[model samples]
Target: MTESKADQPDEKARPRRRQARGERRIQQLLDAAASVFCRAGYTSASTNAIAREAGVSPGTLYQFFPNKEAIAVELGERLNRRMLETHGVVFTLENAALPLRELIDAVLDPMIEFNCANPAFLTLLQSSDAPGHFLEEHAALHDSIQDRIGELIGVRNPDLSPERRTHTANMAFALFKAGLGLILGHEGAEREAYVAELKTALYGYLAPVLGTEGVPAQP
Candidate 1:
């Protein structure tokens, strides 16, 4: 009778409850880590500081992540995954077919919004002391994004050779990164102004590169 009782639904539920709590704890730590990384940069951020930010003890944080690098690696992976999601929305066929100005608006706004909100993404990406594996992963993420941009360009301007398409995508991404640095350097109205500036710049560049292919009319 005792052995049978051990296999009851209540017993199974206990592990699940514990797992839910563990998951929540992990997320809390990650959120705190983001704040710390953004404020102090990856090289300067400490596990103790992250623990304090999360309202937990240092030991508690250790229970989830072995070290600061582990926390950074996990955070970088999640941020990179979130970035990949942009392809589904902004890089779609419909958006690709929009006018150059509209395409710039549709793509850059949300991308900028994400980077502004999650400044730690840039922190991890630019950190000189970031873990080696994380940097490799970020490199992969960059290539994937470039590939997506190339595909989007091909959709609008199919006449361009593959080399030209790749070259255009690289230039567009480089321009966005440069503009992003300026955009992220400021806050509030200044940042918004930079966003507008970036869109205008992109329009000027893409207008001629994309030509008159499938691009729709702009107002």
Candidate 2:
């Protein structure tokens, strides 16, 4: 007997619909969490506040997350994944031949944009009241970024010994982190000036080791 299209089991479609709804709900919760954390700080943030921000009942939020920490963990994981993706693009062979200034810009621009758009990331990470495990997870992501930056350095400056490359990479990451702080801490002309200065400083530090000479003067 031939079954009508509408009479088919439709098992796959049912799960797909349910999964899509579930994902949408989770996104709502995370978005609300980000806003709440940003405004209230991690310690002051509460599940009830997040639920209100999400426009869902407290029970609904609990269905997706056990507590505020779980919400933070998920958000941190998502941000780390994005950072990895940005680094992957910047550290590729295609970008290895870029001039020192352009290379640093390529790496820093996307990262800075991400940080600016997701201010809660910095807020949650820097808060002393955040869970120890959450901080540890963030630290691990930072280390992964540093390791990849070391690899990129080796690719661009093949003569550098592994130890020297690691040291340089660590220093460069520290500088980049500080640059992020400065950018976030200012606005308008000051932020633009700080960004320019950061690029020049990075170029000067990198040029000697990367064997790139006579790089253009800073703007």
Highest TM-score model number: 1
Clash number for candidate 1: 0
Q: lDDT, candidate 2, residue 6?
A: 96
Question: All candidates' TM-scores?
Answer: 0.90, 0.86
Write model 2 residue lDDT over 68-112, tens digit each, in one string: 989998988887777777777777655666777777778888888
Per-candidate Cα lDDT values, in order, are 0.88, 0.85
What are the runs in model 2 whose C-alpha is more than 4 Å off? 1-9, 213-219
TM-score for model 2?
Answer: 0.86
Residue ranges of candidate 1 with Cα displaced over 4 Å: 1-9, 212-219
lDDT by residue for model 1 over 34-134, one digit each (tens)? 99999998999999999999999999999999999999999988888888786557777787887677778888888898898889999898899898888
